[model samples]
Structures are given as C-alpha cells and as structure tokens.
Target: MTKPKRFHPFYIVVEFFNVIKYWVIPLALSLVKDELSFSWWQYGMFAILFCLFVFDIIRWRMETYTLTGKTIHVNEGVFTRKVKSIPFSKIQNCNQRTPFLYKVVGVTQLKLDTGMDGDDDTITFHVITIAEARRIQQLIQTKSDSLETKEQQEVEPSVITKEERTLHFSPTAKDLFRASFTSLSMFVVIPILLSLYSKLDELKEIVPIQWVEDQAQSFIVQQTWIMMIVLLIIMVCISFVVGIIRTFLKYGKYEVSSDKTHVYIIQGLLNESSFSIEKKRVQAIVIKQPFLKRLFRIAEVKLISAGGIDHSEAKDDINSLFPFLPRKDAEAMISTILPEYQVISTMHSLPRRSLWYKLSIPSYSWILSTAIIAGLVIWVPALQPYTWLLYGVSAFILLLSVLRKILAYGNTQYVMNGSYIQMKHGGFGTELFLTKRTKVIDVSVERGPIQKWFDLATIVTSNRGKPVLHRFRLSGVPIPLADTFFTWYRERDQEISIVNEDQKK
Candidate 1:
C-alpha cells in the first residue's frame, strides 16, 4: 500500500484568507468612490486591476515548504516551478511568532534565518502548530549534528535540553512602578495632549457647544494654584495608566535561560515569542539607561546580533530579549553571558581637538535656529518681544557648543584580552558600547576638509547590517597610530572569520 501524502492544513486556510483580503480592500474603495463625487473610474480601475494582478502574482509565487530529515525544501513559482533546498547545517536560527489571530486558529508562524543575509532573508511557514514547529526544529538540529565528526561531536553535547532556570531576582511591584515611571510614554503624552488641544474647535461641534463654552470660561477664571493642582493630578493619573500598559505589554511573563551555546528568551502577554541567540553570532552589547531611567537605577540591555532584528517588526522585537533590568543585575548578567566583553570604568571626556571641530564648525541646529529667527524678525513683528529671548538662547547655545567640544575629548580604548573595544565621548546621554572584535566587518578613518585643519578623524566600524560611526578629534594621538589601530582591527576581524570557518568545517 502507498503512504498517504501529508499536507499542511493551516497554510491552505491562510491562502484562502489572503485571496478574500485582496478583494475586500478594492470592494471597499469602489463603494467609497461611488458615494463621493471623485474620480470614480480611475480609482475603480486601479483598485480592482491592481488587486487582481497582486492576487494572481502572489498565488502563482506561493510555495509549499516542507521540512525533511536532512533539509528544508521549498517549491514555488508560477509559470516555472522553482525548488530551493537548504541543508539543515546552514540554519543559524529559528524564530516562532504567534499572533492573537493565529492562536485562535491553532497555528503559529515559523521563520528560518541564516547568517548569509539580512533579517528579511527569512523563509516563513504560516499556520503551523507550535508543537510541530518545535519537532521540525529538533529534527533539523539532529541532522546538523550528524554532519559533524565523532571527535568534534564528543567535544560538545549532542543535544541541549530545554529547562527553566529559576531567576534569583524577579521584578516586584516597586520595580514595575519604577520602570513605568521612567518610561518614554511620559514624553509621548505631551504630544497627544497638544494634538487634542489643536482639535478643540472641531471637537466642540460634536460636543455640546454651551457646555464647552462654560468650561472654557470657568478654566479662564480658575485660580492659578487650583489649576496647577488639577493639572498635576491629571498628569500623574496619565503616567500611571501609561506605566501599567507598557509594563504589561513589555515585561509581562519575561523569562531568560541559557544552555552551553545559546541564550533563550521567552516573553509576551497576549502573543508569545521565542528567540535564541548563539554566542558566536553576537556583534555588540549595548546597555542604555535613559536620563529618566537612571533616576530609578534601571537599564535596558540590547544584544546586536549579526543581522539584528527586522526593521518592519521593530516594535514587536524591541521588548524581545531586550529586557528591562536593574543596572547592577544587568552588569552582572553581561559578565556571565558574554565573558568575551568587559565593562571598563572610565571617565567620559572628548579629545582636545574636538573643541575646535564642534564650536568653529556649523551644525544643523545652528542653521535651523538662525533661519527661524531671521524669518520671525522679517515677517512676524508680533514675535518681536521674543527677539531678546532668542539672542540670549543663541548665546547660551554657542557656549554649549564650545563646552561640548571640550567635553567630547577621550582616549579610544580597546580591551584586547576580552576581544572587545570601547569608545567613550563627551555629550548628553553619552554611551559606552562593548562590541566583539571579530564582529567588526570594516574599519575606516575618515577626514573632511574641516577635520583636516583641526587634526581630527572619524573612525567608523561597519558590522553586518549597518555601520556605527564614532567621531574622534585626534587630540594628541599621532595620525600614524590611528592608522595602525584601524589596520589591527581589520586584521583581528579576518583572523576570527578564518577561525569560525575552520570550526564549521
């Protein structure tokens, strides 16, 4: 007897939904054009024809993905069927995303990523059961292990078991409160309130005009102290609500675990997500405590992986693995998880040459402020009282620009023993990044005409996806030394690449 062909049940349903969704948008637009006295024919033709073409194109290109014992095979294309086979050994990471809608349909989306491409170079299988996905992942890993020789296999464990580790420190109510209070949501509220205020006239048409007018008159007559108190209470309430929602969305049920080779993160409230970071793939570790968060001694940790996170899904991935932790605990955790990088103690200072480069040179802010002041003086005489204020502000800005240059001077330090480099500078919200030497893709020393006179150079290091540019005024270091450092960084990166290649072999 022949074996029955197995089919992915959920993918079929997803494709059906996709076809309906394609039509729904055009149908809605057609209705809108008929009701309004607009160019109906143009919109009708574009919407219907465009959607039809998209539907046919997508349907034709859609492929069926199957995970076998040794590799993943994807068969796709319309006029000509194309098949792509990737050996399990080349698979770098597997991610699972379950949306609220997906959960209802008992399916999850699985994305397979490799080291060779950007985050978008992922093969997704929609509408697969979580258990089935895990099973497929294990099978791939097992096949990948079989490719290794006996001696190499013996050096490391054949398989890593998934077990939950008890966290020594869990977030308490106080911790949650501190995190929420320090959140960027506080700043976001001001913009929302301003938008509402601007639309007050329009809102009055919908609301009772008499009631709004009475409230406006009362607001004008209210005592300053009473109004101040009321505003304070309102802001506090808003902050509390924002904090609670941010906490619940970001940190709810967050878990961290590690095996010999990977750090795993499982977190979410409504929709759960799981990701594993291989020790070898990490490029840099950034620990940031914004000005507000510093008051509560809380920091956010980010691991810049080879390809990093997908830009399209940044909001979803921002809270993924990038956990909010106490500053002290985050420091200790980094020491353990990434022993290759060290956190060094150093004072923030800019190179001496930075002073000349910053103050003497023109910046975008200076040009913008000047233009605005010029426009106001020429056109809006009503803003004449603000003229004196602008002059004082410009003077203060000039002083700051000079001070900023002085403060930015610093010695670039590379912690060679741990294979990490640290560059410190002077500025508001100054940061220290610890990145692996091997992860540095390219290093260049750049100097423009302005920098040439001041004897300043900007050192830029390119990782996989984008480059991190660090500007340093030469201060006292000889240009020859800076060139040597650039060469050394490049050489180190090449050496690490060869080593990783050999290990793979």
Candidate 2:
C-alpha cells in the first residue's frame, strides 16, 4: 500500500495573537497602576485572570482545527466540546480575507460557509498561508463533486434532472471605471467638502490665518495664471489617483465563473477572496443605481444569500455579487445567468392617491427637518441664519420628495413556476431574483394611517433573516390583485412542501 503524503505543520501565529489579545486589558491596567496606586494582590489577581483567559482561547483554537475528506469538522469548547462537521456538499460558499499584517506574512484567513446553517454556524480558519488555504478549498470542491456524482448514480434516473447552464464573466477595467465613477463616491465628495467647510475654523487654528490670506492674495494678483494651471494639474492628478485606487481595491483581478450548479466569484488586490454560491441557496437579488449612477448608466448587483453576515444595523440584507457593473451589460448578463427570472417594469407615473399622500401632513421629510431646525434654533442663536436657510431648503426638499414619490411609485412582481419564485424590482436599474418557494419563511402586510386612507399596502416577504418590503399603492390596482398575490405566495409554499414529500417517497 502507498503511504499518504504529509503536509507541513499548521502555523499557529494567529493562535498566538489570540492568546496575547487577552492580556491587553491587564497590560493597560499595569501601565496605570502607579498613577492609581493599586495593591499587590489586585495586580496578582489581574495577571491570573489574564492568564486564564489566554489559556481558554488557546484551548478553543486547538479544538477548532479540523480536517476531513467528505467534511471539515470544527470542535470548540473550554468546558463543553461542541463539535460541528459540515459536509463538503453542504458548503455553499468559501471566502478568504487577509488584513494588512496577514498580507505581510503571506497568510490568509479562510471562511467556509454552508448554506444549511445561519451566519454563526460558518467556520473561519485564520493564519493559514494563501497557498495552503487554496489547496484545502480545491480539495473540498473535489470531494463535494465526487459525493454528488455518487448520489446521482444511486438515485433513480426519473427522480433527478440536471440543469446545465453557462455563466457570465466579470466586467473589464473600462467597465469597472465607468461604474465606479458614477458610484456614491462621486456624490460623497460634496459632503466631504461641506465637512471641510464646517471645520474651517478649527483648521485655521492649526495654520496661520495671515499665511492663507497672503497665499490667496498672491494667487489672485501676482501669479493668477500660474496658480490656475497648477490647481488644474493637481485636480486632474487627484481624480486619476482616486479612480485607480478605487478600481484596484474593488475589482482587482475580478473573475466570475460557474458550473451547472454554482456561481463563483474571486476578487481583491492585497488579499484574494472567493465565493461559491449554489444556485438553489440564493434568497433574493437586488440591483440598485443611485441618481448619479443612473446618469452614467451604471448599476450594482447584490445577492441575498441564505448564508453570510447579517447587516441589520445598516439595513442591508443583501451581499453584492458584482459590486459594480455597467447598467446595460448587467441587465443582459442577468438574463443570461438566470433566464427564469423576469425583470418587472417600473411605473412611470404614480396613482393620484400616492401623490396626495406625499403632499400630506404626515410627510416624514418635513417632520424630520422641522425637528432639526427647531433644535438648532433653540441651542445656537448664532446659527439662526443657517436654520432659516435650512427651513427654506426643507420646503424645496418636500416638493422634490412629492415629485419623486409620484415618479418612483411602483410594484415589484414575483412569478411562480413550480417550486421557484421569480421576483423583480427596480427604480433605476432592474433586478431579477429566483428563489425556491420553500425557502421563504414569513409574509406580512403593513399600512400606515395615510396608506390605509389612501388604500395602499406595503407587502413584506421574509426568508430566514429579514424581510424585503414592497410598497404597492392599492389604489392603482384592484383589491383582488393583492389577495391574488398573497394566495399565490402561500400556495407556492404548499406546492414546494408537497414536492419535497413526494421526493422523499
């Protein structure tokens, strides 16, 4: 019999860092001990506590390191050993994240995600070399492929059907730059400039006011043409630098590919990361383009996967598949990648009732701005002019909101085909989502007083983590249509359950 090849010893640098992190509080306390006049016993107790905590982390790391052929087993505990073995077949995605320090040491952290469990169940292995991590990933993929092949053979031919498909690749450099230029970054400059203006008084304290006045005078009078040329050159250089850095960080060596069953995405500059999401595990898809991006014809595509971090704080429930893409090409690619989904047509005009709602007493923007202005007027008399200007601005904003609400009101539609639900929605750039009906966890309907009076309802559909709210003005459609939608969604779930039961038999 041939002997199995042995790999190099697993590096424990990350484990060492984990151990040392526990001493940070004690070390800080020791630094302040002389000033605070701490007792010897207290010092000794702190040291002992730090040591215990450090040991506990080391023990946890040791238990967590695991390897397997068909699965990777991670067992962690200080007191109770909790073992989790995630099968290779269950792994829906894997990603590598490396911090600057890890990059210096040529190491990367691997995160393995199995769609079967929530974000907490995912495993992370830190301080592994990039080459070794890649090797492990490839091995897992191979094992998964073999298992799938075996399972296919064992199942009856009539029971299973293969869905063969090709995938769209990532965009090129030009495409990335075009998309990124239209990103929030472009509009972000205005806020940054305003912040600089707000802090000008503080900045004047750091530099002599006389020096700035002297420079301004010289630029305006003595060297006007020369200063203008220099400023223009500087601005051009800054813009170029910004564009290059943004592209390098976001789309550096971006690649997207797929087999019949999964979509793979690999990207990054300093630290390469990759994600493989099985088709069936995707919960939803969202495509959005801010007003600025719309002008440049660019869109961002996001995927709401069954597994990954929960971004409840930011109210972002989806993760980006392609962070940036040209609007026209992205729409084309979606159709090719997920042909079953149909992009819904966004409304060009709002119902009269929706228009009235926007112009009514309960306008959120008006109420918020009024509160802010009131607080500013009460606290800072010197800022009263600014407050008055803000109040005037709020009136304009309220008008704009009413106009936008009229223009942007629309209903998202979802089509049912067997076990799959195809969803679509967009204001600027269209998005199409296809998810198994069985994956939906909940459904809800909400109405505010204004919406109730206007005969409007906001329908929310949830999967595992959070729900996607679709605001539909009921005045535009017959009441029966909403009932039809609710019925379709409920029946779809029932149909999926029956299908699963039949498959079991």
Candidate 3:
C-alpha cells in the first residue's frame, strides 16, 4: 500500500565496480593512448565506459521493491520497464547473500525464487541493510506458515499430524581440512594450464619463439630432472592454493538445519549465502563421491526437486545439504532432513553375467579400432612409428576402460523398501540416488538381444525435471529383479492414489 523502498546510496560504488570490470581494455588503452597509432580506440573506450556508467547509475536509481500482505512487487528497467508481482504462496525458496565487501558494510542481497527454471521470475534485492534483509525473510516465512495452516485445515481431519522436528549441522575444522585435500578443483587447473600452453602462438607476439625454444633446450639439457621436480612442486602448490580459495569462498562457515517442513542452509566466506527449501518438494536425494572424495571417506549430498531449479544453477550448495561430510554423517543428515526417506537398506548387486553385458559395446569397438590401426601400420611405411604409438596407446586405453566397466558393474546395486527405492552405480565417480516410489513419474525397462540372452535389463526412472530422467538408472539388472522393482513401484503409486482419495473425504 505504501511507497516502495530503494537501495542504499553506497550501492553506487558497487555498481561503479561492476561497470569497471568490463573496461579492462579501455583502462589499458588510456594509459598508453599517446603511444598508440589508433587514437580513436582510446576515445572509443572512454565513450563505452561513460555510457555503461550512466546506464548503471540510472538502472540502480530506477529500481524499487515493495511488499504487501500477500504479494511482493519489483519494478526495474532502463528502457523496457518491467514489473513483477510474486505472491507469497508461489515462492518456493528464500535466499540471502553477503559478499565480503558487503559484510564489512553491514549490507546484504536477498533473493526470492518461485521454483521457476528461469531467473526472470525471481526477485532480487541488490543491496540492503542486514536488519532489513532479516525482516523480509521473516515476512516471507510468516506468509508460508499461514498458507500451510490454511491448507491443512482444508484437508480431512483424519490426515496424520506430523510433529515438528529440528536438526542442526556444521562442519568441524578437521573436516574442512580433509575436504580441502580432496578438492577436485585441482583437475580444473589442468585445463587452464593446457589453455595457456595452447596460446604459445599468442605469446610469440611478445616473446620470440626462438628464444623460448633455446631457453627450454638449455634448461632441459642442464637441469632436466631438477627443473621437472621444481615445476611439479610449483604446479601442485598453485593447484592447492586455487582449490583452497575456491573451497573457502563456497563452503567457509557453512551451516545447515532442517525442521519438519523446511531445510535451511547458510555458507560461504567471501560471498555468504543462505538457502531455504521445503522438505516435501524434494524429488530425490543423490549422494555423490568422486574418486578423491571416496578415498577421503567424504560425500556430497544434493536434492533433486520437481521445481525448475537444477543443481547446475545458482549457488549449487542450495541443492546440496552436505557439500563435504563423512559418508555416515551425510546419510544421517539426509535421514534427518527427510524423515520418510532412509539411507540404509539391503542392496542387491547386479548378476555376474551383467559384466559382459555392460562391456559388450566398448569391447567390440576397441577390437575393431585395434584391427584398423594394425592394418594401417602394416601397409603404410611413413605411419609406422606413429601407428605403433597409436596402437599401444589404444591398447592401454582399452584396458583402462575394461577396468572401469568392471568396477562400475561391481559397485552397482539397488534396493526396494516399502515407500522408497534406491539405485547406486558409477564408473569412477559414484552416485547413490534415493527417492520415494510415489515421486517416480514413469518407469522403463529395456532389453536388447544380448540382454535377453543374459536375462538382464536396464531400468530407468523418470521424475519431473529436464535431463534428470535417466539419472536414477539401474543398468545390467536381472530381468526378474527389474520386474519385481516395476511391480513394487506400480503398487506404491496405486497406494498413494488411494490415500489421496481417502484424504479428500
């Protein structure tokens, strides 16, 4: 009913920095304008920066937000003039972020998500006081609570009453250190190194290639082993530093807690964020352990929700209840957050015949490739050296692939509990997926000629999201087991329908 509020004036500085990030070339040009042949480039840079600066200032000035009893409104645009009104009941998540700089200034950012896939439907407050942020959060929670009460009253009186329960969790210093040691970000650094190596042609413009080659030759001849060791140490050190920095920014001071209806997570060192999600909306819980994480006995737990939000989008930690926790602790956390879901069950491993079933395609392909390479080497004289190298490399790769397939088959397992079903499998990085049978939208069982011989089938589970349909797959499962799984899920579906009808009365 009243007028909307604006951000703090200090936000102009924030906008200024944001705009400046895009002016790297412009800034460099300004410093050397007198030495450059094209004076126009310098002026052009200034014009671009000036335009963006003015646009950012106007955009920040025009943006305003308002909250009413039932709806929240946001008005923002430079030329198009967009307006959004989001009802409190439609909001699925409430999150807050505080960058290190913003924290120092006692300001934070608040975001409201409507469970829509695109960010266009979301509401964001760029810069607001911490007090205001907390007040707004309380307002949203109050509305959700009122709506839940009304919905409960509308349902039949015989509906079971769920008691309120709460669980709080935070990582210890020791756990954080172990997480840092197992960080997979080091692999990300490999690509950066390769990219730099690939840009040697670009570097030639500044430093002569001949000089680089000569330096390399001399270093290799004089101190090959010493330099190799030093380089290895340096790369390891750099990777560790980068990994630690990234880990801290994402998970420092992390905390999570869940109640009967909602789960809340808060984390980050440099850019802190808080995420809250309803418990009932979760479609599945996935426990992930990459090689390093598995070796360290830690796992990452994430949720698959029917809502449009994927794990890949915005603050992925929002989907993850435990980014880095001991395997047992992670399972305990999942059980606490989702009481109806349990992690422990008798797992049925895939049949021994499933190994050949899994490896059939890869094995045939490798054999065909090896034959082709052998033929080429026997006929072509020039390709002899390269051909032998290729053959050896291919053989090694085939061996590795076979090993991976065998391990994956051995690790694969599935189980059927009363209300829940779980599938666990992976090549190197493993995933354990658990979901209620009622949440599974569809089930498909596939059998090729080979699978039919082995009496094996691959069962795929479909839920309500893009690209996650086949995520919960039990590959190389025996036909009988697959049939049993299908029957159990179908019965659970019917039971859920009957319960819904009973509640309607």
lDDT of 1 by residue, 1-505 (tens): 1222223565655666666676665555555646644476656755866676566546534656666656677666656776766777666666677767777877787766665554335556666787777877666555654565456556765554444443433466666656666665555667777998887775454445778778977987775878878878999788668757767666665666665556667666678776665666677777665655655666777676644456565455632334457777887777776666667765334455655566667766766777777788779999887898877776777677655555544333333334566654434334446676677767677777777887766666656541222222223333555686676686785677789899788
Q: Top model by TM-score, which number?
A: 3
For model 2, name the residue pairs that clash.
none
> Any residue pairs clashing in model 1, and if so which?
349-409, 350-407, 350-408, 350-409, 350-410, 351-408, 351-409, 351-410
lDDT per residue as tens, model 2, 1-505? 1222222223344555566687765556555644667778667867876676677556644564556656676666667777677777776667666656777877777777665544345777755778978777776766655554666646653443433435566667776666556553434444666897687675464345768767988767876687889987887667666766766676665776666666677676665566666665566666666666666766777656656543543222124657567667776666666564444443233345655664563568777887887788889889886876878877887777665555444533445565555554443344545555566666556667776777765555666422223221223322344575577677765677787887576
Q: Candidate 1 at residue 460, lDDT?
A: 62
Per-model TM-score on C-alpha atoms: 0.75, 0.70, 0.80
Q: Indicate the worst ten consecutive residues by lDDT in candidate 3.
A: 156-165
RMSD of 2: 7.2
By TM-score, how accurate is candidate 3?
0.80
lDDT of 3 at 392: 89
Deviation in angstroms for 149 in model 2?
Answer: 3.8
Instruction: Please say which candidate is ahead in lDDT: 1 or 2.
Output: 1
Off by over 4 Å in 3: 7-19, 36-38, 117-121, 150-167, 184-249, 307-316, 363-390, 465-470, 491-505
